[model samples]
Target: MESSLSFSLPETLVLPLKTQLISSGSVPRSPSKLPFHHNVSLTVSLTVGTPPQNVSMVIDTGSELSWLHCNKTATYPSAFDPTRSTSYGPIPCSSPTCTNRTQDFTIPASCDSNDFCHATLSYADASSSEGNLASDTFNMGSFDSLDMVFGCMHSVFSSNTDEDSKNTGLMGMNRGSLSFVSQMGFPKFSYCISGTDFSGLLLLGESNFTWMLPLNYTPLIQISTPLPYFDRVAYTVQLEGIKVSDKLLPIPKSVFEPDHTGAGQTMVDSGTQFTFLLGPAYTALRTEFLNQTTGVLRVLEDSNFVFQGAMDLCYRVPITQRVLPRLPTVSLVFRGAEMTVSYERVLYRVPGEERGNDSVHCLSFGNSDLLGVEAYVIGHHHQQNVWMEFDLENSRIGLAQVRCDLAGKRFGVAH
Candidate 1:
């Protein structure tokens, strides 16, 4: 049977530029629905456990296991109290779900002293979460209540700032066995992100795009074996080339392919806020972009103008200019498809960096070399106002351009 669900996202919740840059860090079946919000990260509010304890979770496609702050702490004051829920059941260490199905996690699962399934999840940024695997009844929007597996996190650690304090945990929507989408057996899911507003729409299960804009498809890449610094379970794709306006950059196609170590593969990750490319491709694109805008925009050459030590192409915009001058467009050429980005989406206005009537704007694309990864990532900032569909069954991704605000209304989920 074909199942589907629709939900809305709250208005844009703008955050500090530093927090937004640092936090640069979900699915159903049977027609269940839930709404989400656009904070620095995409978040969804849902009730878990018996009698329902509401918690906000960040939606991360790059991750697998879902987790929540289980106990109150000096940092997480509003954590979920498992003692108050009767339906909360921790998985046993002997269970196959804990021992056999944790290969997708960054760290292997282990047995705690009490024989409970101990889970340790790690991220690329060195942040980590440790807890026990547990199940509880989850309710969201029109979705029916069902017992879902998630991490009852007892501890969280991060090397960066405490930017995630406002969020309870994270919802993983990747292709791993423990992810929400994989656990629910959802065949397909879609989301439309708005560029102008925070209001967006997320749909799960079988989606009907007949009434929406036409879509272009690209095959999803699959890696059979695991490699260090590369996520095999991510939504990987082949990036053929790149075009600055109508001119394709002079970059070798081999620069986009993964090396023997499985690096350089491109992934569409909603968890990251900005796009990143490998060193070679990034350098070529950056040089071409600068050449095209040589006279149009004033370049910032100060050594301290870098953003998060990733984005370096900074520009100075006068406050008197209400509208930016016509800038070149960028197109990401993919296997059998391409996505063209407008000038506005290509440059990001640095928040909290405005000095009097002058403001600092930087190119949204960053170099992945700083992260010590040889992979390309298409982040949420580049996906604004686009309809992105992940078809797990067919192993393909669909892309289309549409006004997300209107698309939300059309789905009858306008917030």
Candidate 2:
């Protein structure tokens, strides 16, 4: 029987930069009880093991293997203690799941001296989790508990300390065999992220969401042949062109095509915080954006003004100005549909004390080339207030603009 479930994502603030921006009133906030914070990531709560120990996990569509910090380390106090769970069963190295089913992972599964299936999962930010593959009962607010496979990470290495400690683990929502959505046998799942509070609703299985707004769909691209650096399991989509203020850029369509190595494809990733584009696409966008904002806003030409070595197109705003000048809209034209990004989503107000008297706002889009990945990624910031549905059965992605806060209230998902 097919089972459907709903999860309410509560906002948890992470990343010092975003925290400062929210505190400084640079980012908008709501006065309601469910106030929205510009959180770096969205997290959902779930119970694990026999006694049902609660765990908070980040929702990451870009990744496949779900994992949890295990065996109380000095750093992680809320880590899952597998020994305490009566139903905890570690898969042996001889199991097919450890050998053949780990293809979705960047690193192959290995056998430890204890004869258990060991796996190492790596991320784009150079962080990694080394752990053993194990099965446990997951109670995700469903009528019945599910026996699911996940990683019990013993050691985690992360470059960003502030971002890593926010969540107990990550719940991978990708299309891989071991992902939460795939393991649950869900044909379709939908999520609506509130632009105001960053709180959202995640619905698993076929659910009607068109009552909010009409959804426009685009076919999901599949990579038949795999390459070393290319991610074959991502939610890949065909990007045809880009339009700044409804005017299409002069870039050719070939620039968006994947090379023989399968590198230049575009992916819709919730794990990434900011949108990133290939060299050609990013350059054209930056040039046109600067050309449009020349007279309206003061440009910040300082070489040190770059954020994360990707966002360099910055503008200075007086601290006294409560309202920002009108900015152009950016539209990402996909094969069958286009996503129009509003002016607020296009610019990120820089947070720090270094900007003497004026506030700095930079283009939220970044150059993907800096990450050495020749591809485009649409991040969560661009997905705000959007109802995104991943229809696995039809192999397509559906998108619609919605007031997610209201959606959450209507669905009784708001906390």
| lDDT (Cα, tens digit) per residue for candidate 2, span 293-362 | 8899898879876787788898888888878888999999999888889988888888772366788888
Model 2 vs. true fold: TM: 0.90
Weakest lDDT window of 10 consecutive positions for candidate 1: 13-22
Q: Pairing residues by index, what is the TM-score of model 1?
A: 0.91
Clashing pairs in 1: 12-198
For model 2, where is the 10-residue window of minimal lDDT? 12-21
How far out, in Å, is residue 391 in model 2? 0.5
Could you tell me every candidate's TM-score relative to the true structure?
0.91, 0.90
Compose the digit string of candidate 1's lDDT tens values, residues 1-415: 3333243322221111111211212322123345576756777767888888878788788889999999788887658889999999999999999988898787899999999999999876578999999999887555557678999999898544355777788899899988988876678778777887767867766666578877889999987877885688899999999999999998998999898888888999888888999888989999999999999999987777778678999898997888889899999999977888899889988888875678989999999998776689998888888888898989999998888888777666635
Q: Model 2, which residues run further than 4 Å from truth?
A: 1-38
- lDDT of candidate 2 vs native? 0.79
lDDT of 1 at 348: 89
TM-score top scorer: 1
